[model samples]
Target chain A: MSIAWYLAVSGIVFSLGAFGVMTRRNPLVVLLCLELMLNGANLALIAFSRMWGNGDGQILALVVMTVAACEVCIGLGMIVAIYRRRLPINVDELRELQG
Target chain B: MSTVLFFLAASGVISGAVGVVVLRNPFYSVLALVAHLVSLAVLFLLLRAEFVAAVQVVVYAGAVMVLYVFVVAYVGGESDSVGERLRGAGGTGSSGSSLRLGGAILAGALLVELLIALLGTGLEAIGGYGAPYSPGPQSFGTPAYIGKLLLTRFLLAFEMASFLLLIAAVGGVVLARRRGGLGEEDERDLLTPLDLMRPRETGTMAEGVGGRTP
Candidate 1:
């Protein structure tokens, strides 16, 4: 449809993701929220690419996807480590060193 | 009709995204996130970004989320008191919440501004960018353009991404294998708490006095 509608949807999704990361204590949830934010950006980029008749934005979206994949790879590792250290994967309990 | 379809798809995406945020259980959040990804893919399709939409489904909803699900199940149950712990942790106090909300607003505003600026300039004429590119929606949406562009122009970045993934894989394995490896626990030790839930067979049926006394 219209580009404005896509942007608006992206904005709402990104805001929800931001709120999730801010409020949720679980690292896994935080990662999921981060994915939402990235996906929101991806949507906006594709919409812009379509409107502007350029492939640049689409290419950038591809780069973002690659980055997102890498992020998940590492984030999942961290989650597993957190689970190991505390026997429970809670972000609040993850603090091992705090001065 | 296209506009209506786009709106419906966008709303579906937004709802799933909100579910990802509002759900308490991480497992459900991941599932909702997958739903969100699928809806976004549909939005991409509506925008005529067929290649992008296909990649979105296969890469995100197919591969990435499966990794998430496995990780979540492997992590298993977490402490239900995590919220209380965070409240006491002194990290994301009330101020943090406000700042995060503000950050979200700021991001949204910036995105709006960008879109507005781009829109004011209006859509640039197609096939006018130096050379006449492929014609038709399908031609533009083919992976060939993307493939050549990424390989010839963005080759270095692609290599770097490969390196990053390599590191991530190694790190995940190392991190998962480190301390509390679960190797020391025997069947009996692991079953300590779970074993308590099982009901044992009674030696005599008559002991319960259901039919007759022994």
Candidate 2:
């Protein structure tokens, strides 16, 4: 119930997401990790909102949710298109934009 | 009771998040992500952000996760090869060990930074950090309260969000669409040169030429 506990949990989850993003070879898995990171931030926002006895944090969390949805849609659309063009979905092999 | 629920949900969130990152299969990772989102929604409810919690469940867990599942299925299930490659490359070699070591160091550094920022600062550095926990007004996080705020203080933002979502929907449809000239002979003939150049390419070109020729 304490703010510190929530913040600690958020930090751990965010770090895990970062690690996954760094290590995962699959772009889809990377996107999933990004969602984990976003959820971590949302958790912190709501916890702070509760700590402050206000609704602003929750409202911002809602906005973050919307942004996340948009990101996932565009991300998955790109992934699908790429998958269609290439049989395998490997982030390492997606070096065509390395210029 | 609330504290107990928070602890339970927090554990669920953390464990599911770990599963998402640690799972080799994208399908299982998606499942873990769903669990993580749902537990986070529960945590939101415990924090009294009921409306946000509902939105989290409905939008994130229900809709967004379904989209992810569809994509995972569409991309051919169980990309075990990718996982195998990652592990093979990231293990049993000096460079791989160094990379793992670097990742661990980076993660540890982040953990320390967050702990220092959250615990050492005593909450005042973060605006509204010291606000007394009063649960404010009877309708604090109810749908009515959020709706009022959305329509009044944040009306423009709400409208912009909707507009953004509309654009995203159209963009997704456009990006997900298959090429329109797939059935056209002219387009096929045009692509024949490229297909001839790379006959072994494993993609739409190969499929198109193979289907047409055979």
Candidate 3:
């Protein structure tokens, strides 16, 4: 497969993810969409890594994975705290931080 | 063979992503996310990043997804109404429809721009970045090669990542626990050690015991 094909696929997925983030109200779903975007970037990175004949891109991908894991840990923790405070998790209800 | 697999995995990734966005149920959305992750791993394999692909499955599909499913099942309310709110009127009152339309337009524009850029660049331009179709050595993306690079070149980054994970674990625990400390009510609300050991039963203990007697 051509590198262009991979890039195109990555772009499509990233756009879809951006759409999800914009349209979805649920915080968890929004977080999932963010994961989609991250995965799209990872795909592009791997494609470039393959093309470059270098291990750097793959290493960067591994770092991305670690960061993604940490994001999930902290994100879900916050979600749980929110659920406890409000009984239901809704992004629309979280207006306290609005300044 | 590789091209066919790439198309199949790409389709799987796209459809699963759409399902995640379009599905009303959070459970199904999570399932779709799992499908997307697995197929992305397949794509990584096709790209010859075997170690990364394996880590994708183990970390994303295995650990992170399990955490998501647990939170969805245990903590999340059965708010089908939330999904309806998302689909019905966009939930922001007078600005709802406009927001939806605006978001759609924005995303479409982004997709178009990306497609144009990719196509306009020409395949030869991208091909000139490196060796193009050459898969490098047999050990290029293997675990051994990755491990060597991690230990030697990327040692600081790898160590920092480990520290980050440790902090994440500690922060998650601290955040999830009640702030007032383990009071009587908090203790009652929290899952006990015995609760962890026992299988989760649907009805009252009396009902469970009575049913078992029969």
Candidate 4:
């Protein structure tokens, strides 16, 4: 019962992330959407783990949190540096890197 | 009842996610993202993954979002410029259009794959592996177990992660200071003549120009 709710919520989050990545030009917004996607997946894992009555899911959630924190630190650093360099923070501006 | 609640939450999440994606304004996207995060956290609770849900709210909703909001506020001007620049992306000459097309195609394919995988996986019935396995009598969900896992088996990893975070914190402070830097240095004597002309320090220049000056 609860698993169904989790799956549904996760699905929504994933879709939102996919949509954000697709449409939003701002890299920061894209990053936020990506975080949403990851969080959704974490919720799914936890839900399934709970349904199965195991600690594995909880552990996985812990790992996810650690990874999320690391990602935020690294991601923010890059964002700030890019801003300092006066590089475009938009996806459209990132095309300069392409051949 | 549970199924109904799950369906409702799922719909809420999906719509909010759509808003996150389709919304042109970054602020709206953030709002949608928050909705999605909160819904997912609630769903975690429903699944009996109580600890996981709590951590999700605390770490993701609390910490991560705060960081994101800070960055967004800092980049307010850049984001407005993005709105102006987005106009250039409509024509065929622009790579933005191509990338957007490619991204759409890829996202669609991935979504289809997810749906297929979810539908195909036979995880409908809860605790299908005979009876729902319960933990040992003494092994109820407790902070002790998690703490023990972190401090004992994963102690090295735990400490290493903390060390990494320390590095990141120091790095952030350094970068922030550099961004708004002001430090005094005597221009004339910061580097003396001898210091600047060390042969080894200047590499081939020592043997080249200095040696040739008769």
Candidate 5:
């Protein structure tokens, strides 16, 4: 298969993630969507890494994975904290930060 | 064979991504994400990035997914009830529905645009169909190769990532520790009242704790 097939799949995955992030009220779901987006980007990066015949993109994917780990950890912690506090889990309702 | 493998991985990726979105429960979303990540790992293998593929499976599918499932269980299904309740109460009202529609439309448009751009540009430069598999040097994507690159060219980034992970650990710990104390009950919780709706408004938290906090 050509690299375009991978890129196209990546794009579709990314768009699905974006839709989820935009529509989902649950912070956890949003976080999952964010993961999707990150992976979609990583797929493309790995593809390009193959095309250019280098390990740079693979290494970049590693760093991105680390960042994703951190983001998800903190995000889930916040969600748990929010739930513990009796706060609504809906992001729309948790607009205390709205300015 | 490679094309079939690529298609299989691609289908998994696309289907998993959709499942993550379409599934209502966060637990299911986590599962879908795991599938997605694992399929992505397969794709990485196709790309000849063996090490990254392995790490993707271990880190994303194994570790991160465990955390997600744990949180989903801890928070319980009630975590998602807030949305339905708000919708039932007409809390967000038409704006909420419109926002949902708008978001879906915008996302679809974005996908179309991305596909167009990718098909137009991304297809031309890279490998064409039926390209033979040419696995790169044996050293490629090995932990050793990546480690060397990290230490030499990306040394600063590597250190910073470790630092960031440390910070994230501390932050998660700080965020998780109850405001009152480890074992102590709140003598008026210093947290949870930031909402304009008063902590009692939703009545969602455990019966006694929220009432006592204020």
Candidate 6:
């Protein structure tokens, strides 16, 4: 198929992830949706790499993976801390920082 | 052959994404995410990103997802506290749940925007359909080439990524550890300024935030 086809699929996946982020109240689910968004971008990178015929996109995609790991690490750490504190896990409940 | 396989992987990817969003329980949603990640790996492979594909399975599916599982299990196994709170306060179509509705509309708008941008410019500059998949250098997707590029061309970035991992490890440990500094008297984390200012007599926490008079 065309690289455009791949790009289209990537866009759809990304939108789904965004929808999840918007709707889900659970922080864990939000993080999962974030992963889905990143994967969507990764798909585009690999598709373009195939089209342009280079490894740069693949390399960048690897970097994205590393960044995603770091993100999940910190986010989960925060969630655990919140749980430990007896705070409500609902994102709606925890608005201490809201101005 | 490749096209057929691509469609199959595409179906898996789309379905898994839907599952992650629609599954009410996060445990099931996490499982759905796993399916999505694996399908993504297959797509990576079809794109000839051999190294990335393998790493996607191992790092994402094996390592990162496991970490998520551990945290979710730890938080969840104790009680379904998170789930309960989510459903009670933020169930679909609830008055305060307009964010979901807005998000749905915005997501659709974004998809439309992206499709228009894509379709207008087109991928014709390079090959779109039936573009000859040219295998560049033999070492393209091999770890050796990537490693070489990492050590040579992208040395600083590679080192920084390693350092980033170290920082994340330390941050995780520090943030998650219990500190008994705050006692029952200090319920500061529970009370936002808005909550305290709104008069304790009226409105729940969610309502207090939204109905602020400022």
Every candidate's DockQ is 0.36, 0.50, 0.59, 0.42, 0.58, 0.46
| Per-residue alpha-carbon lDDT of candidate 6 for residues B1-214, written as tens digits (9 for 90 to 100) | 9889999999999999999998877888889999999998999888778889999999999999999899889888323344555556665436535776788999999899877776567458434652355565654677777777778888887888899999999999998887876666667667687876766548777666777554
In candidate 5, stretches whose alpha carbon ends up further than 4 angstroms from where it belongs are: B89-95, B122-124, B127-137, B183-214
Worst ten in a row by lDDT for model 2 chain B = B125-134
Per-chain TM-score (chain B), model 2? 0.74
Q: Candidate 1 residues B1-214, lDDT tens each?
A: 8768887888889899889977777888899998899999999887667788899999889999999999888877344345645654966567656765776676567656655654455544321222233566345556876677678888887688778778878876776676744566474464565557655444335445565433
lDDT of 1 by residue, A1-99 (tens): 456667667767876777777667678888999999898888878877876766777788887998898889888887776666655566656667431
| CAPRI tier of model 4 | acceptable
What TM-score does model 6 achieve against the real structure?
A: 0.81
lDDT of 1: 0.75
Report RMSD (Å) for each prediction in the order shown.
10.3, 9.8, 8.5, 9.3, 11.4, 15.0
DockQ of 6: 0.46
CAPRI accuracy category, model 1: acceptable
lDDT of 4 at A79: 72
What does the lDDT read for residue B68 in candidate 1? 94
Ranked by DockQ, the better of candidates 4 and 6 is 6
Clash pairs (backbone) in predicted model 2: none
On TM-score, the candidate that comes out on top is: 5
> For residues B1-214, what per-residue lDDT tens digits would candidate 2 score against the true structure?
9779988998999999889988878999999988988888887787778899899889789999999999989897566554556667776456655776788788889878977877678666353433454454556788988999899999898999999999999999898888755686675565556767764545675576777543
Best by DockQ: 3
Per-residue CA lDDT of model 5 for B1-214, tens digit only, reads 9989988988998999999998877888889888888888998888778889989988789988999999889888556655666576976577867988999999999999988877787345565642234545546666777878899999898999999999999999988777865665674465655555554546545655557554
Instruction: Give the Å error, residue B152, model 2.
Output: 0.5
lDDT of 4 by residue, B1-214 (tens): 7667676766766776777776767766677777776776666655655566677678777887778778778877357445645566655436656776777777777666665565457776432321254455334234665676677777776787778778877776655444533455665555678876675534455566677543
Number of backbone clashes in candidate 5: 0
Candidate 4 segments whose C-alpha is farther than 4 A from its true place? A2-5, A8-12, A95-99, B77-101, B122-145, B152-157, B174-214
**Native contacts retained, all candidates in order:** 0.47, 0.63, 0.62, 0.38, 0.77, 0.65
For model 2, the stretches where C-alpha displacement exceeds 4 angstroms are: B80-94, B124-138, B180-214
lDDT of each: 0.75, 0.82, 0.82, 0.66, 0.83, 0.83
